[model samples]
Target: MNKLKFFVAALLMIVAGTASAQKTGYISVEQVISLMPETTRIDSLLRKYQSDSLNPQFTYMVQEYNRKDSMVSTKDSVKLSAQVKNQIRQELEGYAYQIQNWQQITQQALQGKQQELLEPIYRKVEAAIQGTAKENGYAYVLNREALIVVPPADDLLPLVAKKLNLKVPAAGAPAAAAAPRR
Candidate 1:
């Protein structure tokens, strides 16, 4: 019995030592991305895409809807064939539906565009974070946003930002403003 108790105590000590050796760090990826200079350019590109491409598409859809609606309203329905009238009505309804949901459609398009533009930036940040963690002997890096009761882990933002050649605000300075959500 004494030998068994000694073995169990030894096992516990080993486990505690292993746990203590592993270092953890936390970082806010959004914060890092916000500090990246490319983010501003990406925001500008997204706005241009919305104004130049999406807006024109919406305008064309509205014009087509108006033209079809006017044809159905102003023309003599009595003289029109039943099938032709039904087809035009269906087209008008489709256009109306699209127009009604334009906001959702445009938002999705903008989000997709934003994601495409930010993909490379995300990869770059990921690489920097990994390098920082390895260089600083961190065993795990947690997302700051995901934690509520964070333990005494190192804040890896400054280290990761430096690794990426990005500037971090001085201590006690206001946190970097988050990038605009699409």
Candidate 2:
């Protein structure tokens, strides 16, 4: 009777172990953005904005115009003799002031919009990640980008990226921004 009881207990333990070992849980940190369309759209908009801001040819033209305008002085008749030069200088200065004001307004607007757009989306993503982890019965999760808590080797970035159709480079590789080419 004792041997039969022991055998039954051991069989139950094996069944329990097998059932609990089949987990459908994994971490997804960096690829969360790729899976989200809104995030991708916003990212593209920001990249275009940044590229427009760094326009080199336009920058050179603005600098050259400013240099010529600064060399003009209304108080000195010799330098201001050409009515055309005076007119050009006045127009350039006015345009420059307008551009400066426009840039300031645009910068403020971008800041407000970025906060408005990113904060809510970030909160939603965080909640979804937490819920997903809980639902899938994850025992542990760690961000591939911030592999500080969980064992680094257990990072699931590749899996998540593959699922989301995004690319996640290996560690020590330069980030997209730091990469030499766009």
Candidate 3:
């Protein structure tokens, strides 16, 4: 009976030790990404794409819409031939459709551009995180935002940033506003 009890106690200790040995760490992914110099470059490129490409295209579309609208509104419908009036009306409707969807189109373009510019940077950050975890023997690395109870020691932001050769921001440093929301 004593032997049986001792065996069960040893088994419990082994199980508990194994569970406790698994290292869980957390990283503030957003914080680390913000510190990377490439992020600044990517942000600048996205802004330039928006201002140079999307804005001009949107302005042209708006102008076209306005021109069609003015023709539809100002032209004398009674004196015009049925075919001409119908053609003008069709043109106006097309312009209206384009105008209505313009914002969505621009927004999609912005998001697409952002993703294109950020993918490589994101990959680099991921590699650094992976390397940090592997070197430190972290079995699981959670995003800081997702964690409920995190100790300061378990935060891997500095380690990952170091691996990426970036400086970590001071604890009380104000965060820079990120690029416009998607």
Total clashes in model 2, counting residue pairs 3 or more apart in sequence or in different chains:
0
Give TM-scores for every candidate, taking all chains together and pairing residue i with residue i.
Answer: 0.88, 0.38, 0.78
- Per-candidate count of clashing residue pairs (backbone under 3 Å): 0, 0, 0
| Pairwise TM-score winner, candidates 1 and 3 | 1
107-157 per-residue lDDT for model 2 (tens digits):
665666566667765676566656655655665565554443555445454
Candidate 1 residue-wise lDDT, 102-144, digit = tens? 9999999999999889999999999999999999999999999
> What is candidate 1's CA lDDT for residue 67?
86
- Among these predictions, the greatest TM-score belongs to 1
Error of 1 at 30 (Å): 0.8
On residues 1-182, what C-alpha lDDT tens digit does candidate 3 reach at each position?
99999999999999999889989999877777778787788888888998899888878877887875666577555677778878978887876787789889888888898887777778888888888999999989998878788899989888987788887768898775553322
Pairs in clash, predicted candidate 2: none
**Least lDDT summed over 10 consecutive residues: which range in candidate 3?**
173-182
> What are the candidates' C-alpha RMSDs?
2.3, 11.7, 3.7
